[model samples]
Target: MILINRLRTVLAVTAVIVAPSGGTVLAAPSVPAPVSAAAQPTAPITLRYEANRRSMLAAGIDRPDGDFLLFDPNGRGRVAQVFGDLSTARRIAVLVPGMTNRLANFWRGVGGKSYRSPAVQAADLQRAGAGSGGFAVIAWLGYDTPQGFDEAGRANLARAGAAELERFVAGLVAVRPRATIALLGHSYGSVVIGHAAPRLPPQVTDIAVFGSAGMGVDDVAGLGTGARVWAGQSDQDWVRWVPAARLFGLGHGAKPAGPGFGARVFATADVHDHDHYLSPGTDSLAALARIAGDLP
Candidate 1:
């Protein structure tokens, strides 16, 4: 009951008792439950995205370029960086990058690299839909990506990273339950998504793999999610040469960009090499923006 009703009853009882005679007086009753939705946490879990953002900037662990959705201080640092307004967004785009990505370079693009950093890519995707209040692009470097090309040949990191990826998706769903989520996994990250696909929430509507070595699955149907699967390839991407076989656990199975991978090989113009899919004005980037915005 409301506190006012309880106080009124207490006053009535006190009037009939010795309270009027200066004997025993009743104390104010306590409130049972908080009335506002902001009570405790807004959701089942308190992501504290805003708190973490401020903390990272103050400590120099992150930059002022974008917001931090989730951040880990230990070691090389795992993070989820947001490029647009996530709380009010209708669509969400998650960018899971490939090898050699760490907290230090999460936003800083490396010099002479074949592709742009995850941060730049995410920003580009966000700007693509700025007219319609586009998706909240997230650069999720939440796993220990392989340090080099040689270490990337195996699927060990992807196998171990799958659980965390699934949890991250669940957390996003908790915060934006009605938002349409799209997953974009580059290189070895594809294998991580492949393993996590079976357990992904229903809110996820699309999964795209580009410059992937392999997804560790024979076909898109094998991933077990209802989301549409897409693969983008460029003429210069060296990942095409990576063996599509997972024999003896040496590599991820079934190349996603290959002809028989069973994913939609959608429009990919200006495709240069591995990691160039996010280049501005590229067909792949445009298509990706559409997928995230749920636009045709």
Candidate 2:
């Protein structure tokens, strides 16, 4: 009976969150299903970096082999890093991760702990953007995110983080004057991006969201920035089921693949869950490349 109950819970969770888009979305699910065994939680990861105008490398840290600086901003494990073969790129991309996520999650390319993190996702976008031959990818893993089902009330952590993100962009602009940015946000990160959009400068070329709930907008103009807004969601993304009416109250909503939200709805063909967007050779990656590449 206990096993049956667990199965039921898993199904309920899956059905409530995953989308029904079918094969267009990668079938892999981001969250694990319920298990009978008690799951042990790991120590929460943390990090911080005191960013300054000029060079991130000047801050003093072991820079990754890639032509960018990688630093543990808070020394808690969270990372804030940037990537671009300056010799071959002119555009810059900023990637934001979701809940309970840290810096290490971005570079776990495929298997290791970092396999599906924003770093890995940014790398995928980097390669795709490389087709255009002049782009940089930034892994902005700074700020403290409310883990689990944290919502509004005592503190709007997402809103606060978005403001910090805006500052990061400003700092990046001051340092790399030639670089224009495309902010790519996933899951709860979309909320941060949405709230911060009102404060962004005109240099932001594109704003893209994947597996997002609602983006806190009634239309594109509400985004408050001139960047082209783009959205992509796998058919099986559970986030699609979060009703818009309930999203504002719960800090989530059902942002659909249609007009009015004011974004260019990309083709999510051959993709399925929230996390699959980082997978190499997927259509999602291809679309991301096209959009990022085409940005003026």
Return the TM-score for each candidate structure: 0.80, 0.70
Candidate 2 C-alpha error for residue 266, in Å:
0.7
Q: What is candidate 1's lDDT per residue for 63-162, written digit by digit as tens? A: 6455666666557667777888888888988989888887777767545352568888888888885557847889888888898876787777887788
List all candidate RMSDs to the true structure: 10.7, 18.6
Q: Tell me the tens digit of each residue's lDDT in model 2 across 1-296.
A: 88867766666445423322111222226434432110101101111121121122443434433433333334334455555653345687788777667543446532354546667677777777776477778777766665656553113767777877887777666555666778888777777888899888777888888877766666677778888889998888777666664433564433735565768888776777767876777888888877766643
- Regions of candidate 2 where Cα sits further than 4 Å from its true position: 1-70, 73-77, 86-88, 104-106, 109-114, 151-155, 246-249, 253-256
Score candidate 1 by TM-score against the native: 0.80
Q: Model 1, which residues run further than 4 Å from truth?
A: 1-47, 62-65, 111-115
Question: Pairs clashing in candidate 1?
Answer: 237-274
